[model samples]
Target chain A: MRDIHTSAITDAVKKLCMEANWNLEPDMLRAFDRALGRERSAAGKQVLQTLKDNAELARTKRIPYCQDTGMVVCFVELGQDVHVTGGGLYDAINAGVSEGYKEGYLRASIVRSPFDRVNTGDNTPAVIHVDVGPGAEMKIMVMAKGGGCENRSKYKMHTPADAAGAKDFIVECVKTAGPDACPPLVLGVGIGGTFEKSAILSKKALFREIGSPNPDPALDAMEKELLEQANRLGIGPQGYGGDTTAFAIHILTYPCHITSLPVAVTIECHAHRHKEATL
Target chain B: MSVTTANDGIKDLSTPLSDQDVASLKAGDRVRITGVIYTARDAAHGRLAPLIEKGEKLPIDVRGQIIYYTGPSPARPGDVIGAVGPTTASRMDRFTPALLRLGLKGTIGKGYRGDAVKAALREHQAIYFGAIGGAGAVLSRFVKKAEVVAYEDLGTEAIRRLEVENFPAIVLYDCHGGDLYQEGQKVYAREGA
Candidate 1:
C-alpha cells in the first residue's frame, strides 16, 4: 500500500487552482486559433482574437483570465491501495482552495448562504466528486466553473421512445443560452442515466480536451451533428452573430433504466479553464 | 498586450457622457469610451434600490455616468486592477430603470435587457453597450486606474470608480429602439434557417 500525506494533496490542489485560473490549456488555445481562422463575422473574429490575447496576458502576469474566478469544482480519483494520512481528503482540498485564492489573489466568489448573499471570502469548500479505483495513484482534476455559464446549464428527462428528439433539445439549450452565457461555448452533454447521474456525467464530460474525438464512434458522430446545429443558431461569439457559435461539443453517455432517457447539457464559456494532476 | 482603441471609424466618447453623445450612437456602432465609469453588480444594485426607495442619498452621484455590471477580480500588488469585464446585464434589469430615471446615461454589460429596460432607455435617452463578455484581462488594460468608492466590505461587488482609456464596446441597444443582437442574429441566422 502507498501512503500519501494530506499536505501533498493540499499543495497540489492549491497549485492546480491558481494554474487553471490563470492559464488557458493548449487545447483551448488551439480551439481559439481554429475558430479565428474559420469565423465568418468580423465581430466574431475580433472577439476571438481579443480572448486569445487576454489568455496570454493572464498567463504571463499570473492574473485570472476572468474576474469571476469561479467556484471550484474538483473530481478526485482515489486508489484503494493508497492510505490517506494527516487529515480528511475533503478538508485538505478545501484548505488548498482557500490558500490558492488568497495567495494567488483570485476572487473569492463563493457565498456562505444563497439567500443571505454573503461572500465566503476564502472561496472554500469546492464541489468535490470522488471515485475509488484499483491502483495506488490519486488523480485530481480541477475546474474553475463560472457562474454565468453554469446558470445556463440545463437537464431534461425525455421519454426513451423519443430518442430522435434528443439532438434538437440539446441544440435548444444553446439557443436559450444565446449571448448571455458567453459564446463560443463548449457544450458537455450527458445522455442516458439517472437524473442526477446524467448531470454529473455532463459536468465530467467537459474535462475532455478540445479537438479530441469521443471514444465511442456513435457518440462522436452525434457530438459533431450537435455542434453543427448549435453553431447554425448564429449566436456566434458573445452573441454578436456569426458562424462559430461553439468551439466543441462533448457527450458522455451511460446505460440507464429502460423507462427514462435523461440528458443534461453543461454550458461552458470560451474561458474554459481546467487542470489535472496525478500523485 | 494590444487593447481596443478608437480607430477605423470607431467613435471615441468621454464621461460624464453628454446628451449629444447618447444621440450620436446607434445599435451596432463600435465605440471606445474614455474617462470615468463606475462598477456595480447584483449586490451593489440590491443596496442601491433600497436607498433610492427610501429617497436617501446614494454614496455616489450616478448622474451622466455609465455603470458597468461587473465584479472584478482583486488587483495584484502594484497593478492598477485585475481582470475586470462585464457580467450578465439582465440580472441588473430591476435596478436599472431607477438608475436611468436618475439620469444614468449608459450601462456596459453582456446579454439582452428586458422590455422594461428598453422602454426606460428610450424614455430617458440612455444606451446599452455590450462588452466582450469573457475578455476581462484584456478589458482591464483599458482601465487606467481603479479605486473602490463605496461598500468596501462587499469586496469584488463594491462600487469602483475607474478611469478608462478607449474601452471598446458595441452599442447593443440605443435610444432610437435599434437592437444589435436581434439585427445581427437575423442576418446570420437566415442562412441556418
Candidate 2:
C-alpha cells in the first residue's frame, strides 16, 4: 500500500482554505458574467457588478471575499490501497483548518457547541466526508460554506408517488429563502436517497461547476427545468428583483429503499468557494 | 478601490438620523451613508436585549444610531477593517423591536425583516437598509475606522463602533412601511406572470 503523509494533507488543506476564501472559482466568475448580461433589473445588475468588484478586490488585496469566512467542509476520497501516515486523517484535517484560518487572517466562525455557543478560536473540527475509492491517490475537495445559505438548506422525505411534488418543493424552497439565502443562488439537489444520504448527495452536487451538466441526462433535464422555474420567481440578484435569480441548479441522485424517497436542497450564495487537490 | 460616490438620485445620509431623514427615504432609494455607526450581530444583541429588559444602561448609546448586522473578518496589518458584509438580518428579528423602541433609528443588514420588525420600524419612525449581501471586500473599503465598544469576549461578534464614509446601501424598509423585497418582487414578477 502507498503511504501518504498527514503533513502533506495538512499543508494542502491550509493552503486550499486560504485560497478558496480569497478567490472565487473560475466557473463561478463565468457564471456571474453570464448572469450580469442576463439580469433584467437595474438594481440586480448593480448588485452583480458589486459582487464582481468585490471578488476582484478580495483577490488583489489578499482579503476574504466575505466577512463570514465560513465553516470549512472537506470531502476526502481516500484510496483503499493507500495508508495515511503521521496521524489520524481527521486530526490532520483539523490541524490544517486551524492553521489556515489563523495564518490566512480568516475569521474563526465555529463554536465549541451549538448550545453552549463559544467561539472555537481557530475554526477547527471541519465537517469531513470520506469515501473509499479504488486506486492509490487521495482527493480532497474543500468548500467554504457560508452560514447564510446553509441556514436556508432544507430536506424533505416524500412518498414514492410524490415525484412531481419534488420540483414544486424546490421552487417553494427558493421562494421562501428569497433574499435570505442571497439571491442568484446555486442550488444543489439530492434525490432518491435515504434521509442523511440525500443531504450528503445534495452537498456533493455543489462541488460540480456552476454550468456543468449532470452525467445523467434525466437529472440534467430536471436541473435545467428547476433553474428556469426558480428564476421565474423574480427574486433576482441580491433579491432586489430581476429575471436572473438563480445562476444554476445541480442534481445528484442515488438508489434508495422502496419505501423512502428523500430530497435535499443545499443553497449556495454567489461566493461559491471550492477547490480540490489530489495526492 | 475607492468608495462608490452617491449618484443617480441616491441621497447621502449621516448618522444620528432624524425623523425627517427617515421620512424622506423610500423602499428603493439607494444611499451613501457616512458618519458613526454601531455593529452588533446575534450574540451581542442577545446580551443587549436582556440589559435593556432589566433597565440597565447599555455599553453603547443606541440613540438615533444605525446598527450594522455584521461580523467582520480580522483586519490585516494596515487595513482599518477586514472584509465586512451584512449577515442574514432575520436571525436578529426577535431582538430588533426592543432596540428600535430605544430610539435606534436604522439598521444595515441583508435579507427580509419579519412583520414584527417592520411594524416596530413604523411605530418608532425607524428604517432598515440593505447592503450588497456578499460584497464584503468592496463594502469594507468605506469603513474609515473601527473600534470594539462592547462585548470584547464575543470575538468577532463584539459590538464595534465604526466611522464610515460614503458607505453604499439601499433602503429596504422605510418608516412609512415601504418594503423593498415585497415591492421589487411585485414589480418584476408581474412581467413574468
Candidate 3:
C-alpha cells in the first residue's frame, strides 16, 4: 500500500483554500463573458461587467472575492490502496482550514452552533465527505460555499409518478430565490437518490465546470433544457432582469428504490469558487 | 414597459438624507452613496431590537441614517475595510419596521425585502438599496474609513460606522412603493412571454 502523509494533505488544503477564495476559476470567468454577450438588459450587462472586474481585482490584489468568504466544504476521494500517515485525516483538514482562513485574510464565517451562534474564529471543522476509490492516489476538491446561495438550496422527495416534475420544481425554486441567491446562478440538480444522498449529489455536481455536459446523455439533455427554462425566467444578473438568469444547470442521477424519486437543487452564486488537487 | 431613470442623475448621496431626497428617489435608479452609513447584521440587530422596544438609546442614532446589512471581513493591513458587501436583507426584516418607526431613513442590502418592510419604507419615507452581491472587494474600495462602534465581541457582526465615497448601489425599493426587483422581473418576463 502506498502511504500518504496527512501533513501534506493539511498543507495542500491550506493552499487550496486560499487559492479558491481569491480567484474565480477560469470556467466561471468564461461563463460570465459569454453571459455578458447574451444579456439584453443594460443594467444586467453592467452587473456582469462589474462581476468580471471584481474577479480580476480579487485575483490581482489577493483579496477574498466576497466578504462572505464562505464555509469550506471538502470532498475527498481516498484510494483504497493508500494508507494515511502522520496524523488523522479529518483533524489535518480542519487545521488546514483554520490556517488558511487566518493567513489568507479570508473571513472566518463558521459559528460553533447553528442556534447558540458564536464565531469559530478560524473557520474550523470543515464539512468533509470521503469516498473510497481505486489506485494509490488521493483527490481533494474544495468549495467555498457562501450562505446566501446555500440558504436557498432545496430538496424534495417526489412520488415515483412525479419523476417529470423535476423541471417545474427546480424552476419554482429559482423563481422563489429570485435575485436573493444571486442570479446568473449555477444550478446543481441531483436526482434519483435518497433525500440526503440527493442533496450531497447536487452539491458534488457543482464542482463540474460550467457548460460541461453530463456523462449520461439523458441527464445532459435535461441540463440543457433546464438551463433554457431557467434563463427564460429573466432573473438576470443580480436579479435585475435579462436573458441570462442561469449560466448553467448541472444534473447528476443515480438509481434509487422504485418507490422514490428524490431531487435536490443546490444553487451556487456567480462566484462558483472551487479548486481540486490530486496527489 | 417604460424604463424611468428617476434618480439616475443623482449619483452621490450623503447620509442624513432629507425628506425631499428620499421622496425623489425611485426604484431602479443607480446611485453612488457617499458620507456616513452604519453597518449592522444579524447579531447586532438582535441586540438593538430589544433596546429599541424598551425605548432605550441605540448605540448609533437612527434619525435620517442608513443601516447597511453587512458583516465584513477583518481589514488587512493598510486597508480601510476588508471586503464589505451587503448580506441578505430578508434576514433583517423582523427588526426593520421598529427602526424605521424610529426614523431610520434608508437601508443598503441585497435580495427582496418582505412586504412589511416595504410597507414600513413607504410609511416612514425610507428606501432600500441593493449593492452588487459578491462584489465586496470592489465595494471596499469606496469605504474611506471604518470603525467598530459597538458589540465588539460580535466580531464581524459588530456595528460599524463607515465613511464612504462613491459607494455604488441601485435603489431597490423607494418610499413611493416602487419595487425594482418586482418591476425589473415583470418587464423581462412579459417580453419573454
Task: Assess each prediction's global lDDT (C-alpha) against the native.
Answer: 0.91, 0.91, 0.88
- Candidate 2: deviation at residue A149, Å? 0.8
Could you give me the TM-score of model 2 versus the true structure? 0.98
* Model 3 stretches with alpha carbons more than 4 Å out: B1-10, B190-193
Please list all clashing residue pairs in model 3, or write none if there are none.
none
TM-score of each: 0.98, 0.98, 0.97
- Which stretches in model 2 have alpha-carbon errors above 4 Å? B1-7, B190-193
lDDT of 1 by residue, A1-279 (tens): 999999999999999999999999999999999999888898888899999999999999999999889999999999999999999999999999999999999999999988998889989879999999899999999999999999999988899898877777888899988899999999999988798889999989999999999999998998898888888888789999898888999999999998999989999998898999999
Q: On a 0 to 100 scale, what is the lDDT of residue B107 in model 2?
A: 95
**Which TM-score value belongs to model 1?**
0.98
* Candidate 3, A68-140: lDDT as tens digits: 9898999999999989999899998998899999999889899999999999899987999999989999999
Tens-digit lDDT string for candidate 1 (B37-79)? 9999999999999999998999989888999999999899999
Is model 1 an incorrect, acceptable, medium or high docking prediction? medium
Candidate 2 global lDDT: 0.91
**Displacement of the residue A141 alpha carbon in candidate 1, Å:** 0.2
After superposing all C-alphas onto the true structure, candidate 2 shows an RMSD in angstroms of 2.3
Residue A116, model 1, lDDT? 95
Runs in model 1 with CA error above 4 Å? B1-7, B190-193
**Candidate 2 clashes between residue pairs 3 or more apart in a chain or in different chains:** none
What are the candidates' individual DockQ scores?
0.70, 0.67, 0.60
